[model samples]
Structure formats: C-alpha cells, structure tokens
Target chain A: MTAATARRDFPRAYGKVGSLHRERLWALRLSYTSLIVAAIIFLAPPVYMLMTSLKTNAEMADQTLSPWLVRSPTLEHYGATLENPLFLGFFANSAIVTLLVVSITMVISVLAAFALSRMRFWGSQTLATGVFLTYLVPDTLLFIPLYQIVGGLGLLNSIWGLVLVYPTLTVPFCTWIMIGYFASIPKELDEAALIDGASWPQMLLKIFIPVALPGIIAATIFAFTVSWAAFVYPTAFITRPEEMPLTIGVVSQLVRGDTFAWGQIMAGALLAALPPVVVYVFLMDYYIAGLTAGATKG
Target chain B: MSEVNLRKVVKLFEGGVQAVRGIDLEIADHEFCVLVGPSGCGKSTTLRMIAGLEEVSEGEIWIGGTMVNDIPPKDRDIAMVFQNYALYPHMTVFENMAFGLKLRHFPKDEIKRRVDRAASILSIGELLDRKPKALSGGQRQRVAMGRAIVRDPKVFLFDEPLSNLDAKLRVQMRTEIKKVHQAVKTTTIYVTHDQVEAMTLADRVVVMNHGVIEQVGPPNELYHHPATIFVAGFIGSPAMNFIPARLVNAAGALTIQLGQGLSVPVPADRTARYAPHASKKLLFGIRPEHLTETTRTDKQNLAPITVDLDVIEPMGMETLVHFRIEGTPVCARVDPAAGAQAGAPMRLAAHMDQMHLIDADTGRVL
Candidate 1:
C-alpha cells in the first residue's frame, strides 16, 4: 500500500482547539526550561576548564567571583606547556601506545568476534557470554593481579608493557561490541558469500568487516580512549621518568616537591584529552550506533 | 547447467528434529523444478540441502553426476536467490554481482562483461552503482537475480524470491524470473507455498507435507489427478472440496452416495479401480471450477448440494461462495454472472466426470 493511502485509512486525530493551544504553550515552556538547565549543567565544567587553562598560575590562586570569563585571556600557559620537552615526549608516547592498542584491539576483536558470532562449535555460546561478562568485571579489581603479572614478566617501566596490558582490557569490550555488530548482519548475506565461492576468511574480510565498519570504528574509539586515559596501570607499572605514558608523565612532572606547575598541568591534561575528544567529534554517529547494537541485537 | 539429483536425502537437525524426512528427486538439465508446500514443510530445507548449505544427515546428493556430500557450499556450483533478496547491503549492485567472480579471481574485464550482460538482461543497468538500501523492493529483487545470473553456475536455486514483493510486483517478477530461466536455461529449482507459482513456473511440482513428499508430478497431472488427498487439497486455491461419501454400485455403474438423498455417478474408466473396494467410506474431491450452477435439464447428473451462503467474495471474473455442507465448511468457485445471493438456496452442479474419489481412511486414490 502507498503511504498516502495508509495515511488516509488511519487519519490522525486532531486535538480540540483549547487543548491544542494549551499543549503548544506547555511544550514550549518545558523545552525552554530544559534547554537552559541542560546548558548550565553540561557546559559549566568545560567552560570552567577553559577559564582555568587560560589563566596564569597566579590568577588561578586569586579568588574571583567570575572565574569563567578570564578578564585578560592569555596564551602564556599554552606556550609554557607546549615548550616542555619532557611533556612533548609524554604526548608522543601516549599517541604511540594508544594507536598501537587501538589497531591491535580492532584486528584481534574483529577476527575473534567474527569467529564467535558466526562459527559454530561446542561452547561457542558459553565463550561469547563469557567474553562480554569479562568486560563487565571491574578493571580496578584486577589492577593488583595484573600489576603482579606485568612485574613477573619483567615488563616494568616500559611503554611496551602498557601496550601489552591495554589489550587485556580493550579486547574483551571491543570484541563484545563487534560480536553484536557481526550478529546483526543478516545471516543471508554470509550465506550468499559462501555460495559465491568464498571461504570463511573471505566471507569475514570481504563481506562482514566492510558491512560492520561502523561497529569497528566504535570499537576503535573505545579502545583508543581507554588506552589514552588509563591512569592506574601506567602509574603502577612505569616508575622511570622516561617510561611514563602522558597521563602519568604530565602529572608526575608537574609536581616538584609540592611546588606544582598548575598552568602546565592543566595544559598537559587538555592536550592529553584532545585525541579522544577529536575522535568522538568525527565518529559520534558510529559510536552511538555501535553502543545501541548491544541493546537491540542482544 | 547440470542435472540435480537427490537420493533419500534427510536432514535431522542438532536436536534430532527431522526438518526434511527422506526425499528423493531428480531434475533434468535446464528444467524448472519447483519444490512447493506450506511453510515448514521441508521445501526450503530440501533446496538448501541441494545447494549444500545444509548437510544431509542421511543419503547423498549429486550435481552434474558428482557426489557433493562432503563438499562445502562454495564448491557446489550453485546460485541461490533468497526470499529477502540477500543482496550485499554494503555494496552497489555492480559489486554485489561481481563479488563471486572477484573471489574466484576472474579477470577484471571478464567480470565486467558478465555483470553487464546480466544487468542488461535484468534491465538493471541504470541501477548498477546504487546500493541495495537505495533501491526499491522490486529493483532489489532484480539486482539479486542479476547477481545470480552473473555466476553462471550449474544450477539456479530460488527460495521464494518474490514473497517480499507486493502483489502486482510479485506477478511481474514471476514472469521476469521465468523469462530469465528461459534465456539462461540453467537447471533451476524454485520453492514457494503459492500453488499458482508452482503451477505456472514448474516443469514438475513437488508437493510436500510434514517434511515428507506427498506427491511429485507435472502441474497438470497434480491438478487433474493428485496422487494423495493432501496433494489434492494443497495444489489448488480455494482448495479442492472433499465431501465425505460412500462408494457403491448402482445399476452396473459406480456411484458415490452423499447420505443426504444425493448420489452422483463416478467416471466409467475409474469404476474398475474402486470395484475391489466397494461399500467403503470415501472422500469425494472436486475443484470449485468443476462445480457449475445446476439447471433443470442438467439435474440428472447433478448432486444436491445445500450451502447457507456465509460470505460472498467477488474477484471480477468469478465469485467465491464460502458455506457449510455435511457439517464441514467448504468453498466453491462459481460464475459471477449467476449473481448468487447470501443466505439463499443455490443449487450446484458437481461435474461427475472431473470428480475424484479416495479412501477416506488411508487417503489414497481408489
């Protein structure tokens, strides 16, 4: 049936004149109130952060009522933070580790998830549920045990050690996302590929991976953000000044016997937070799509 | 194109549920064979088994005289059009058609040539670069057919490819698919529940019930002389009316007595077939089209049929009268020109020449 015919068949009921006008006014009032409340609640912290990042170390200490709009906005703090060689090294180190971790997580999860979602064998259902549940286990609970394992492996004070440990956290979550994505692909598409003379590997690489690209992007964002913002593991495993990831590397150097570089510290934090923020800006659609797949496909 | 053959093929699923009971079939090269039945009657399972998508729990399948029991679907040399038109959603029509050839490492030019040829045949040339998501349902169905045709496989398997289409588009695609089959002439097997599709498309229709083949024959054979009661009932729209009766000999001719002071003569040729089984309870089968409005002059052979017209459905060319008889509900197709009325007595002339009689107990033709 045509949409026009369907519309004619089930005509929309019109509200009475009094209620219709009342509803419009009521909806407008509610929308305006929510927008104002939301703007303040959500934008307040980031605006404050922007003000703090703009201030000099002395201005930050000065108690002022209107701290949000800096009277004299200066780029000195940005310059100061950008000038530190050690800070630059930390930034580079975070980039390398997060990129490697995201790449590794995506590759491994895509393969593992395709297998778990598509291939059938004994214990497959158990193994898939087990993987998703593993992601649910709090990372903090395993930090001590994981630290001990890293110590035993003699991977202390190394970025490689952080890279190795990051996958343990990212793989399960990313694989879970990918499993849902791969499962949502209609079973017929793969059957078509299989009958098209594609082997299992070909089916995954050619058909599934391309079709589930949104999920892959979401998985990558999750892996990259988790690796970039990881504070506990890097702090526990890397003690050497040169070995620290940027999150720890910046904070540890900002303190010199309690005489902290507050301006540089916020600057470094802002810089360290930039990549994930940028990633979300570029791929928010896929991130939201991938997240919803878990709820719907499950 | 290869002739497809199955020898006692059975598919017992993981939970020991037999989706397809033992089935044996053979299709000659370039023949359009339709496996048709109601949903979950093992028709799709049988097609999937022949495509090597499902494993045979027992027996063997041969495509082009090669035993393919252990082979994966990729090596089976078959192309299947799924009910959902399983075109790769991510790819354009060109890529969807080219994927199989690209996987086989077909030369780029050769792949393009084959795809273009199939596209022209399907008249989807203008839509080649559009993704399946961008196309209408009928366009997507044509793209799916184009994809199958580009493969040039040994056999073509269609699993109700037109089920998703609207009625008008379905009828159009039905003819389109038939024309494609005629042009390609690949050994084809189509599965559908609509008997009209089976009758119009198949060189031979395999009617199934409860995972078992009820009957297999040409469409006309099935319509005129069904091998069993299920086939008789399932093969016609406004299905064959089965009236309970008793077979008896009256004055040297076979006659069926309907209990309600109504008796009709059976065909003379079929008299000998039921002679050995006289006085047995039988199910008298007759198609709706074979029953005409009884005129006074033709009352000699007409059986008395009383129907309390519950509903009247007019389809332009004919009118359908649904009512009850012998305490059992039945449908009769009658001429619209006769202007049958609701809640009124309508006399029907049950044509005895085309009437069928079967043993009600065993459901076998007597």
Candidate 2:
C-alpha cells in the first residue's frame, strides 16, 4: 500500500487496460473498414445501374460521358420503360408467375418438410437428403427435358409453363430450408399439440406454420426471386412476346438485334430488380436467420 | 373410466434401440402416478405410450376401458405439459390455451371461459395478452400448465415439466403442480429423473431402470422398504451407503459380519428371512440418518462401531461423517455436536432394525 509500490504497479495495470482497449478499437476499425470495402464492391454494379437508368439516351450514347455519372439525370427512361405496353405486360406476367410459384412452393415445401422432419416413416432420412440433392442439380441440365415436357403438353408459349418448371427449381431448396427449421423445433411442442387434441393437419397450420414463419418467409423470398429472375426456361419455352416473363422479355423486346437501347435496358433491369431488393431490405433479418438456422442447427 | 392400463407394452424404436421393453401398468382414475428413474430409463417412453405419442410395439393400451392401440393422441383425450413448456411462441397466452378448444370446434364463449378459468387458476390472468417469448421461465411454465388445464382432458401427462426451473422455482412449481392436480383430480402420469419430485408429487411412484419397472409403491414404502437395491440407492438423497458383508450363524443367532472383527446382530424378524443366506455374501444397506454418535447407553438393536473418520461435513443440524468400511466408503449422519473430526477415531451406532440385507449377486432385498 506504499506510494512507491503503488506508483510502480499503477502504470503496469493501466498499461494492461489501455492495451486491451486499443486492441478492441483496432478490431472494430478493421471490421468497419472491411465492411465498407465489401459494401462498395457489392454495391458497385447496382449503383452503376441506377446511374445509367437516370441518364438520357443521348448522354448514354456519348462516349465522353462518364458511365458512373449522369450529368443531366432524367426520369424519362423510367417513364418510357413504365409506359411501354410490352413492359407492363411482362411485369404482369412476372407477378403472376412469381405469386403462383411462391404459393405452390410454400404449400408443397411445408408439407414435405413436415413429413420429412417429424413423421417417422420408412426412408424419411434418405428422402430428406434426396430432396436437398435434387436441389443441387443444375437448372441448365433440366431445361432440355423440361422443354420437351412443355412441348408435349402444347404449352410452349404459356405463362403456366414457367409456373410448372419454377416449382421444380424452388420446391427442393425451399423444402430443405423448411426441413431444417422444422427439425429445430422441439419435439415436445408437437407432442403437446398432439396430446392437446390437434390432428396432424391442425398441428401444421396452427403450430408448425406459425412457429416456422421465418423459414417460410425465407423460402417465399427465394421462390419469388428465383421465379421473377428466371431466364433459361422462359427463354426456351415461351417465344411469344405476350407470354415472356419480365426477365426474358426485357432483353428480347428492349434490345433489337444489333441495337442496344442501353438507357431503357438499364432502367428496366433496375425496375425488375426492385421487388427482390425491397423484399430483402425489409426482411433481411428473417432471410439471414432462416438460412443460417439450417446450417447451424443441423 | 378415465383409468389408463398398459398391458405388456413394448416400444422398439428404429435401428433396434429398445427404449421401452414390456411394461405393464394400470393407473387408476384420479391417481397421480409418477414414473421416475435415470435418463434413458424408459420412464418418459412409458408415459408417451400411455399418451399415444409413441406407438405400443407389442401390447395393448386401454384408456377408459377402450383398446386405444391404434388411436392417435388427439383422440386419446390426454393433455401433456413438456419440460421446455412448449408454449407456442407465436400465440398470446390466451390464444395458446384456447387453440385446442378452437380445434375441437368449441363455442367461442366456452373457449374464452375455459381459458380464463385456467389462467386464473394458474395465476397468469395478467399474462393473457403476452406471447410466450415475453414471459419468464416460471410464467411460461404456468402458461404451459394453463394450456393443459384448459382442455380438462381425461388424463394429464407431464414430462419433467419443472426440470428447467431453478432450484427454488422448481420447488415452488412442484407445489403448484401438486395443488393443481388436487383441484383438478385428473388421472395423471408424471415422469421425472429427480427422485425428490417423484417422492413429493406422486400418489404412487413407479421406479424404472433399463426399460423395465423396478418397483411401484408410495414414497414412504419405497424409502422404508425398497423392494430392490436400485430403488434403495435411487430413492434417497445423499443416497444410502452400502457395505459388503457376510451373514453367519454364531451360537444360534444370525449376525452380519461387516468387516474384520465387526459383526452386528440381525433383528429377529429379518433373521428368519435371511437365514437361507447365512453363509452367503450380502450387501448391508443403511441410510446415513440411521447411524448416529454412540452414547454411553445404547438402545436395543443399536450396534456400536468405531472407525477413523476421513471427512466431516458439518451441515448445521447434522454432520455427515465419511469413512471407509472394508475399503468401501460409508457415510453416517451424526449430531453436529458429536465432536467428530477427520482422521480421528469416532464411535457411532447403527440402527440394526433399519438395516437392509440385499443379495449381493442378485441385488434383491432379502
């Protein structure tokens, strides 16, 4: 307790505390820096799209104008894209296809996930693994056979073709996400529900669905985004302008052969990407939680 | 009519894991029966079978005199409270309690009344508006009980519902559950690994081990006259101490030879029962409370022994003196004022009448 010893020990203790604080500060700075760099890298393309979408056709054609900057920003491109009948038709097509596909995917995946996770039938585990493996099959590989199925059914130029094929892509992955989420729920919840006089279907609608809402939202987002942006099937099957989705229609109608209306194209692309971006911005927490819950809990 | 009877019920899970072997139990109406044992002892599995959560692999389960082997849980008229509470996180406390009634298509007013009654019974009326996530552990537990009580099912199944609470909360919840059961008077089957919970809650305790029922009796019956060695060891706190001993007939009196030059005379009633094992090795079982500091004058059936105390745990009211007899560690609960010290020789008296002589080979009480 002497002043001599106190003075000698004080700096050492203070030094230890000071270094700990500095280490934490350095870690915070490093993480923030990396996050900013990552944000810039990822946000670059969207930012460029937004800038280009605001440019006039003449400015876009000018070689001297910086692509990153719209010297005279105009809403004309957005107005043009929105006013185009073909664009409105394609937007309606995407909406119908995305809504139908998401609804079907949710219904099918929730039931499939419930059966795979809780109901102990034979081959349940193998079937669960098989569902995930089916998702791993590339869409490019299935598009050829799918082309025949669409052709055989004489639905080559129909929006229904997209609806049918999109589920094949969306169901497996959505079911896999849902299965992990459902499996993470305590068995006791369902057991208590069962003992409380809830039938299997009642349990799903009342207990499982509400409890696994985040996973359902994540799956719905995946389905909506996937169907909205789908290109390969819509391009291969639906050759008619009226039946083409927003993704394929934008490229096909906006850009004539050897003629790229770059400003309108960028505007349409930005507009098309808006739905998913808005959805993700509003529900980013649920999306990330549902996705990581499967990996961590499993 | 609400009685549940399981006849030779067997549960063999996939991959050949025998969770519950053939278990035959009959729980009478309005009886609070507890199934207790260590984890993986098939106690929970047995309760699940009765609740129709797990299928009976071999035999029939009769609920209210009806063979319900093929009946799903919903049709079986049982309500279960889980260890984790299992309150639906999405629903308000009132909604969670009313969900079962709604599914049954009960009248809206009736459902409201039942939920309100149950919530008031559990003293969670103020919590009716909150979701399960907004409730604390004890509140969630009460909500879970309220969910079950609202149904007013034929049987109540509790799967260690209070195990998640802290010690003081567990004790509080324990009494609350008992009081609820008394008021409701439903045929109940509770499962827990805590012997104290079983001893306190059950009208009858069914002790299970390794997928088999070891014994079924009242708590005092299991304590004072455990039918098996496992029951003796599992049913008491600071469990009963066991010593390897040999019974011998010396001058027409049967005495248990505990160790080198140490013999305690067997009681007259037990002498006849242990006569056949006179020359055989046995396990001498004695609860810590039965052994005390030896006084100047020893009462009848109180055998005196002297041993070097290895450790003395002074527990305010009584001292737990730990020592070894024939290299086997033994504990004796002596008076705190006995002046017992570690590594010092101390005289203690064992109540011979309370001693149990178990067959060492079979682990069965003689």
Q: What is the C-alpha lDDT of each candidate?
A: 0.87, 0.91
Docking class of 2: medium
Per-residue lDDT tens digits of candidate 1, residues A180-296? 998888889889989998999888888898889889988998998899999989988888887878889888987879888777777778887788889899999999998787578
* Span of 10 residues, lowest total lDDT, candidate 1 chain B: B295-304
- Which DockQ values do the candidates obtain, in the order shown? 0.79, 0.79
- How many Å off is the CA of B52 in candidate 1? 1.3
- Badly placed stretches (over 4 Å) of model 1 are A1-21, A24-32, A35-39, A294-298, B251-253, B295-308
Give per-residue lDDT, candidate 2, residue A272: 91
Q: Looking at model 2 chain A, which ten-residue stretch has the lowest summed lDDT?
A: A12-21
Model 1 pairs in collision: none
Residues A1-298 of candidate 2: C-alpha lDDT, one tens digit per residue = 5865665777767555456678888999999999999999999998998998898888888998788987999999899999999999999999999999999999999999999999998999999999999999999899999999989998899999888889999999999999999988988889878877778898999899988998899999999889988988998998899988889988889987889887788899899998989999999999999888877866
Error of 1 at A207 (Å): 0.9
